[model samples]
Target chain A: MKKATIRNVAELAHVSVASVSRYLNNKAKGRLSEEKAKAIEQAIKDLNYIPNLAARQMATNQSKTIAVVVSNIDDYFSTELFKGASNILRVKGYEAFLLDTNAEQQRERELIKTVSSSFFDGLLFQPLGSNIKTIQSEFIHNIPTVILDRRLATKRWPQVISNNVTASKDATKYFLKQGCDDILILSSEVKIASTRRDRYSGVCAIANPDQIHLIELDEESYNYVTIKNKIESFLLKQKVRNKKTLIFSFKERWLLAFLPMLFADGFLNSDQVLITGFSDTKLVQTILPEARLISQNPYLMGASAAEILLKSLSGEDNSKNYEPLIVPAKF
Target chain B: MKKATIRNVAELAHVSVASVSRYLNNKAKGRLSEEKAKAIEQAIKDLNYIPNLAARQMATNQSKTIAVVVSNIDDYFSTELFKGASNILRVKGYEAFLLDTNAEQQRERELIKTVSSSFFDGLLFQPLGSNIKTIQSEFIHNIPTVILDRRLATKRWPQVISNNVTASKDATKYFLKQGCDDILILSSEVKIASTRRDRYSGVCAIANPDQIHLIELDEESYNYVTIKNKIESFLLKQKVRNKKTLIFSFKERWLLAFLPMLFADGFLNSDQVLITGFSDTKLVQTILPEARLISQNPYLMGASAAEILLKSLSGEDNSKNYEPLIVPAKF
Candidate 1:
């Protein structure tokens, strides 16, 4: 069989060769119409044409790749987010490279420096710290990046984040109305990430200061035994005080880790303890059918971030205002 | 701060600049002694030297990047595998790019063709189907590759896989000896992956043909309703026959998806059902404390594959014989 060429695709799609070239280069946003783009895509697919990516990369000075830097990769939330971004990037003729920082700030800084110096077209970052300065210091080459999940202290780039504050506030308000006065906010360290801080603030907004208690787990020292002991102590205290407590988890993994311990200790079925938190999967519901959950659609958040980054890469988004794109979480 | 250069590193380490260059370029296998290598590493760390990967790539015709092709990226098993491989590659100054096939053969073929024609230093592939022919057709450039998880029909490359057959057979034998005669093997499309096929064959070897039954779920249409209905019917049939049954799940996600349904329907605590299969996380034990699990250390398997690929890329492995390295799965 003969190899398909640009001219072949152009002739089959009934478009000019220049139009085909523009579309292949991802410069066809305003130059070509939707109908023409669809026809060209169909013609290429029908002809079984695989464009030479290496040749194209050299010609355009673009690697046609995006770097996705996440805190951790072997988790439910991070993997789903990566999957979402990767799916969109793949359809747009780009590959997403994952860089795991393993939730270490030093590693995150190193990775960001490496990514800034690398030959990637764009970046999707889920930063551990307030990374505006870290990014500004090394991002001299100005690779377009879209921040995911957490917000920076001062926004220098577009961000896609779940509505953590509103969801947590509303959930807390509901619990307050239900006459559950004592509230315990279980979270990972809240200083580094804006997500944890926002959720904590949201709960504190409606609850009494004296009635609210917070336990922050250092991620580096998080273990099954530690979590089990903490939860057991909390439950015992609640039982002695004869007070109903709402256990609000700031992250899904924390909830998943501690819920089993709660079940094992027979604390789940008691009327004194209630549960609610940020969950991304149905696994939480499967484990506790009646637990109120704040569902943050991480996959959708990742896809939206990728779309924004793609637009910025193509010069379609020229706005200077760096307003975040907030994806609402379900209560 | 003054920029650290190769000269500075060599002067600090009391070694020649050429030796430092060779170490940075990953060609210091036999040429540099262990003491010299350690000195060079410490000096580089002390100087905080960041090697220019782009310049090195241009000079050595090495991209310092690897492609990891997997069936799916969103699942726990795949993510764990990728995490392990990525960790090893990063320490070796190579970046691992993930290309998720989404369990599509056509997509896998396209990706393999792309990787073959691209500038990747090596490949770690978890292929679907007996893809020896598919790989050979486009592997004209002979990118050093290491097969992962599943085996190909022909031994064209070194493989790192779990001891699927042995572990499954031993577990099945244990259950058979315990007088659990009726066995239902639940899997996702056994014909496509050797991991599933080997596991199925292992169970078949231990169980009676008349008592063994296999239910294959199409991945595209996998859902709660379908899984729940299938399990309900199987349990009903076992109840009618008054026979004790063992439910063996081939993958972690499958067990996770259906275990909830089994628990909801009150089948978990019944004396008629025994559960065990391939699980990678402690979530299974948390959910069903008594459920026996065959644990495949996916992370270790992935790291082993990356190590093998790195050795081959550095020209340290000259053997032509492709012997498989089996990572033992715990039963």
Candidate 2:
């Protein structure tokens, strides 16, 4: 049987398609007579007319579409951090669109092209740890973009990020002040593109370069369990009678692995093993509320990113000295 | 310092800007001598020209753009379900841009306009539970779009969704065979929508209307604690000694509220009380692993939405089909 359309309903009801549509939408607002309204409703019921939401959307051109490209979906940092951007964008009357790079650089490049073609007024990119520099050039010319969570090697574009250097330095200092001399830093190679490098640099400022246990986790090669065991065994082997461990991570991927190990090793009993990490997810609060965490205000970062992009989109002079906005981390 | 541009590098190397660009891009291959390549690299380094990712995309017209609009970001189903769409869109030669309606019909209409103005090739919209008919009509005029998660009331476009009637009926049968005489149908008030209605019908198909308990949760005034307590007391006061309790929720929001009450009441130990709900989130696994969950495959739904949109964008007639693709529950 052929599917019924708006025209069919209109024809059967002996009215214009617009009137049928208005009646169906309840936009007629009593402009149509009572008899006409009932007839339109009956026609709709009899014909089983279903309107296409997407097709109707294409008629108007004054949409405020903004695309956000991030690394993963499961990460709380990615989603929670977006709260800031979403809140501001909503007030600005812009609809926020999300794109996940899934940590692939090629996919990131492809995403840029796809999002740009979509006529998005602006874009907010949170590149995978290592690929920030790889896609740096693509962001410059085509659209107004703000790089969030990651830092560019060259100071050419607008970016919003946490003060990784100072935050990491402070976190490491806290560990050092707690009388733990040898600390291990479980670092994400991806974060090196952003504050990870700065945080590592901060750690280097305190401890001897050799003293820093900078274990680089290969995201592509290791799953959560494999990395968990590695962190556990590494801590166990350190025969320093103190058995003090301060593990730091800029990305949450490592912590998902770290939490399971802490439970398996029976180290979750107390703060005996000092393990601190970055990110703010509801799960983090529910699972281990006591764990020391570096709360980089994602909401603020998102808002800032949106603000910068809007300014750029408004054709602000590229050479103007718009200072790089750095949000401090809350411990 | 004047930032180095392609033109500056070309002049310094005694070559055309195109030659300089090709050399910088490493597209030179065998066309340029090694000495020339060395000189071009030197000039590029001296000039400090940065490449733009968005501009690079303009050459191919394959911006690889895919717009994904969920009714709201706060809804667990919409975001989690988007995972499937995001994965598929990313894997294919496309990028997914997300839009959040905040569940407002007007915002959805505005989103359509914003998306069309941008460089997006197609759109995937998850209609608002409230006012879906009006939102559906907004997408009828232009651009290729694919609807996800719900069915349209009119046959104006194609939609991807679960086999609502069959799934709901199967769930109701599971409860009936479990020997639950009084099954409670817990759902959101937007039940007039097809999916919820199907679930209600499914319950009516097996159990007596008087024996079934219907709980309608209104969004405007949701007091979860009070509702849970009410349900708990009602279950305890059942006159029949053999009366097993079965709770069927429309989605996880109700489950999140109800399960905690059961656990608190110490009723969680009784197998006589079967708790199951429909939703698509990892939260189900984390909260109550034993509970039978209707796992709507969001990632797959999203991917299919992208696939359908891609086909339509490529000029294939992908409009108005009654047979929505059935995305089975993983659990």
Candidate 3:
């Protein structure tokens, strides 16, 4: 099959290549007659030719692409949330630039600065646990940015996040209703971050002080072996886990390490131990079918965030009026 | 906190700012004393000052970034596959540019052309369906592109895809073992593109001719109403679904449309109507708990694709001799 080109379309339409280019460039001004314009449109249809996007973008200075800066591409929550935002953005005829922070604190802030100065029309960021301050100081400026998964503690910028406190409380309560009185919640260095802190408090909201066990893990020391040992030791110290308990997996890393131990130590025996956590991996279901888990409505949260940020870009009075949007979680 | 800068670092280390800048830029070749280099490195650590990436890229003509041209960023398969690739690429200190083609055949080809001419070190593409022949001309020019998910049927490009034929047959046998004889296989335009056709043939290997029902939807009409109508009409036409049957949702969009109808029409009564499909969504288990699904190992596939692409870029000829790499689906 012969490939179609600008020349072919121009020849078929009986117009100069320049006129055809102007029409395809969406600059269909009085450069061409109506009959010629109609003929060019018909020729393009007949040939099934699409104008090169690069040339078009360069010509118009409008690429319609948004840059998404995620702290870690491997984080299930971040990826899922991004999926939601990208869905809406793509529907709106925008492409996403999926930039990674590689789970580094400073790298995220640096990338944000780069993105702001880049050709992107807007940005969506998942700030790293330790880079919140820098992100606020250097990242979210000049361009319209919507923060996802993590919330900005201060009202310096427009942001969006899942209803962490409410959702965790609901999840904790679900475990509590299953007769779990002693719930051990895992806390990561991310506790310094607002989302983890809110989720931690949520567990305390449902369980008594003595019944709730908090195990703190350094984000830096988070490895499979170290996590497995900590979980085993925590279970050993608890001795008798009579109630269905929840562990607020500050991130997916803890959950990934904790699951194999449950079966290895006979910790998860279907009805006896109703273990629940905030997780992003679907493999959790295959590993422990009975465990109640919190699924962050990443897609909806992301979509809402994109919609919020785009509205802000259009000069809406969202800065003062927009309440912290609380998207529900799926259990 | 005052922002860290080269001036602050120079002052902290009691060194001239020019010396610090030269050291940071790696231009201190025999020009700076060993003591000066040590002092600058220490000052950099103490102040936590980092060079501007955009400035560095501009000065060195090295962006240290790779653009990923995908068909759709919102698709679970695309996102998960990217998660795998991005994880590896980031670890290697490369930023990824995620470009969504919106499954536009013209744009898919155009994006490849654009990326080839862009400032990216290499390109990773997930070709949009079967129209990959559009890119064959450009791909042969050798700009370090590793095609993924779907392979080029007419021309062999450096590509990665799942073992569609074997995986689909295995999936079909699983459905058959569940006592399902009357099976409906949902497919996309089956894009003689790569896996779709292979997967379809694999199903034929396991099931009899009349037992297999192939339903292909229009790619142009991707609306919810259009998809729902096509599915409902197909299901209503089937006469004897008396035996235990299976609905093989070969693609994500198919499953997205099919599962809802199963719930709405009360098809999920017992294990008799076994719903099985290839899914990458966590919601699959949550929404359709009883369905048997063969999850795509997108993360691993992506990681392997990156590793292979890098190896080729590093001048390794191992990839060329290797037939298209097919990562096995984790059932």
Candidate 4:
């Protein structure tokens, strides 16, 4: 079997080679239609083609500035990552600049366009839209880049991820071993993202799939009042949690928004309801000492990502077969 | 008095026009000496000169990108600012980028160098260093930029402040009215800056200067444990909790680090010692509702700064006499 190329993908997808080239270069400019994009994606998946990004990187890149693109600059998770990565970059005398996607995929696309034209040495990215073809197209092949906290289908771009799945499994097991009868897993919104999918799977792996109940936060709108009201109704439908019950949340915001509301509704107490989540919030130690949580240090993850990017930027490491670093979470 | 040019400044400072140009353009490549830089600053002040940055901007300007530079991205203050600005910029269709200085002035100098060469349209800055002339020299006047949360001697550049002075005064008066006999001001230990100077002056305006005890937080090292030890020893020295004692902190981190350790030592109690700070922290609401806090909303400040910057960028408001917006803090 021979290696697939852009020409081969274009032939299989039934588009012109020029169109394929434009799409691969992330220069579609909305000219590539949904149908064409789907066909191209399918063809690429079928072909297992990795864009020769490294060759491009090596040719035109003598860069010093590293750009770290995040979904939102203000989000606690993103801030931690930015802090970690920027600190490392600063010590190495490399300039680190930031671009905010505003938590919108459209903005993410726009930012990639802006950065692609800029003189950046490398990239540390927290992906917003998970299209592998789009990723390949927007991210220039040779620019030493590492995808932060995201899992993609293609192994072309190495990633640094916190093992959310293993941590989720361990959190579920801890409650079960403590004689909790019923378990409730609460995640932010309804997304088929790796964080939610893996955490749910990790829970189902140990517990009975039927017994495990999953509740979404107010997915449509992130109104905490709405989420609180929904939780109130949901808890009432269960008709009083008389047995030892454990509720798992995926983010700190959920815990903060739900805990006091639950406490007010007389549904939460130390005796029956045990709450746990994933965060190392400073408030946890002071306010909610009884609640258990898995500390997935995003700072460390960001620093690691920057380190890899800097290594690649320095041309010290040339091998493309970089292993995905799964940062472990602590209970 | 006639207007002074860069040439005039160069002659006044006993340097060449190129050297003055490099300094003003922030193009000084480790060549501008400390003594010469000081002389240039003094010359600018002595001559009362403002660089015609607008003319420069009009001649060589095609800017759609706004670079927001902050001292620290992860700080609650900076995050709120970034969120507010980014949100507004997104709605206005302007590309907003962020650069973190890690709260270091040197890093800020480095970041400015990178951005100046790029084609950014304007700036929304939160200056960490309080050197007004340095700011004037480094910040191009024509970029339609707004100085956020920092005060300067010259009124050449527009500003939007959260009114730390007014807020601090109000907070101090509220406590003094509540019969807080001994008000202990706990500020992060560092060199004198605008925040500290204004806040301290604000506190002094209402209370007896001698009665106000100001303590420097272990600012030299940000090690929370070292701070915890120092605070512990300080609290032990003051055994008299008979009077209404108020511990006023400047930042949230100080409150969080000190409260937990103090609680463990059995030094803090709701009945005897009262706690108050300047933050709108969610945890503060949840944990210590008894504590009084001045909510100087950073989101609103950030949003307002972006609005001002956008207005200037469009050249719709050519008024250099724009009044500084002092966002008032609420209890």
Highest-scoring model, DockQ: 1
Q: What digit string (tens of lDDT, one per residue) describes model 4 on residues A42-129?
A: 9989987544321122112233567889866645678778888888987996667787776666667776765654445678889865
Model 1, residue pairs in steric clash: none
For each candidate, the alpha-carbon lDDT, in order, equals 0.78, 0.65, 0.65, 0.68
Arrange candidates, best TM-score first: 1, 4, 2, 3
TM-score of 4: 0.69
- Local accuracy of candidate 1 as per-residue lDDT tens digits, B56-142: 442255778888988877566877788789889999988887777878887788788778656677899888776567657755456
Model 3 alpha-carbon drift over 4 Å, by segment: A1-61, A130-132, A137-141, A170-178, A215-244, A247-266, A279-295, A316-323, B1-65, B70-94, B99-122, B128-144, B154-156, B160-331
- Who wins the TM-score comparison? 1
Task: Give the per-residue lDDT of model 3 (tens digit) for B123-218.
Answer: 888877655546665442345678788766543457788888888898888878777767877777775457788888888899999888877765
Worst 10 residues of 3 chain A by lDDT: A52-61
**Model 1: per-residue Cα lDDT over A1-331, one tens digit each:** 3345555777799986446656777644467899999998999999876554432442254668888988876556887788789889889988887777878877777777777766677899888766577756755355688988888766568999988889989999999887786888888788778888889889889888987888887765555566667777987988998889999988787776676556645676677788898988777776677777899888898899999998988889887678889999999
Error of 1 at B111 (Å): 2.4
* CAPRI quality band, candidate 1: incorrect
Q: lDDT value for candidate 2?
A: 0.65
The weakest ten consecutive residues by lDDT in model 4 chain A span A52-61
Chain A TM-score (model 4): 0.75
State the lDDT of candidate 2 residue by residue for B35-78, as single tens digits.
87778778867766553322222222234666778865655677
Find the 10 residues in a row with the least total lDDT in model 3 chain B: B52-61
Q: Candidate 1 regions off by >4 Å?
A: A1-56, A138-140, A213-222, A236-242, A258-266, A270-272, A286-290, B1-55, B135-140, B213-215, B218-222, B236-243, B260-266, B270-272, B286-291
How big is the positional error of residue B161 in model 2, measured in Å on the Cα after superposition?
0.9
